[model samples]
Target chain A: MNVPLPNADHLVGIVFLIMIGLTITGGVIACNANRLVRAVAGLVVCFVGVAGLYYFLNSPFIAMMQMLIYVGAVAVTISFAIMFAAPEESKKHGPPGTLAGPFGLITAGLLFGGFTLLALKTDWQVHAKINDGSVETMGKLLLTEYAMVFELISIVLLTAIIGALIIARRGRSS
Target chain B: MEILSLYNNLNTFLIIGALLFSMGVYGLVTRRTLIGMLIAAELILAGASINFMAFNRFTAPDPQVGQIFTLFIMAIAAAEAAIGLSIVVAIYRNYKSIDAEDLVELKG
Candidate 1:
């Protein structure tokens, strides 16, 4: 096939690779950091990268939601929780179990290897399109086909907020 | 060369999802505190969402389904983080420590 030398696709691919790097680095920091706040920061970076991935997957709406929900709502909530409840440095000096870290690493590596193999070997099937999966169609489906779930999720969020308030405010009156 | 074309391949996304999942597993297993575990849980959710998005992009007939599913996952994750963090606060209040190992009051 005729093509330009080092085309636009190559630039997009390099950007994709950079996103992958950012994602993995964020994940590593989130898991391996010495402090909790740093882990939350890493989680934010990772979620941003994942949002970029969603954009590449042809779901800009989902990407925006990922950014709003994960990076905006979830990460911020986790950081607030850390601020309120994280243990002080002075209390963390006790010796930890020696085997826990190494064992966890080995288990994660094995799991990763198995999953990679499964993903590579599996013969995924493709089907004909019902719709173009556009924003307008998604909105229609969300209101029509998936209306019940949409409503239920709202209820769930309401309950979560209420429950969080009750639980966090339990001991404050003393 | 051909390596740059990896972005269009489903396998690439799947492998990335697997790696994210493994990182979550490692964090969950190794983290000593409840918030740390929660962070890892979010990572796991993210990986699952990526897998869904990949399959949606590559194979699904109704691509909206996976996007919708991923949105639901995000909603659930938001709820989970809220409830979990509140519980974490409660636990810290009761036990004065957020470490998972310190939560042995019910071990008997």
Candidate 2:
């Protein structure tokens, strides 16, 4: 088998490795960090790395949206919630019971191992190309094929906004 | 194997996504505070999006479907976050603490 490796391919591989590192490291920090603010920072880092991976997946638009919506909007909103709702410092530590330590680790490790094995063992089939999956094509499909779902999502967004407002407003009268 | 071409491969993305998912699960199980659990949930959603994108890149005939699905996930996550944070705020107002253990009381 004569397979030519382009110079760009190597660069992409390195970047991919770096992104994976970023994602995993940030995930660790997000999960393990003691401080809430640090956890938020880790979340931001992980989201950024995920965005990079999306770019590699050939959807730069989604990559940008991932960064914008997740890292920008979601992370920022979470940080704001932390600032407002959380105390100045998290001193009230929960009793880390006997099982919390080893059990959590074992569970997460088993899950990760299982998924990794599944991904490696499965021989996924590639289907014929229907479209290039560009932003233009996505727009067309959204309007034509997925119009109902698209509209429903918008309705969901509206309801979420209203519900959030109502929920937040409830305590003022009490 | 060259470093850059790693993105071209499917297994790398799958492994990374799984790792993220595991971390999220660990956090969800271990975190004491609601906000921390929310962060973990976000990580889990991120993992799902990665899997969708990877499948789109490698196996899907219409790649745009995965992209659109990811976008929908993002929108849902945003909405969820908004509502969840609001609920957190309300809970904090009632209990004066955001810790999960503190807000265990139920009213009749």
Docking class of 1: medium
Among all candidates shown, the one with the greatest lDDT: 1
Residue B56 in model 1: lDDT: 91
Query: What lDDT does candidate 2 reach at residue B34?
Result: 88
Off by over 4 Å in 1: A1-6, A87-95, A126-133, A171-174
- Steric clash pairs (candidate 1): none
lDDT of 2 by residue, A28-88 (tens): 9998888888999999889889988988777888999999999889999899899989866
Give the TM-score of each candidate: 0.92, 0.91
Q: Kindly list the per-residue Cα lDDT of model 1 for residues A54-74, writing each as its tens digit.
A: 888888889999999999999
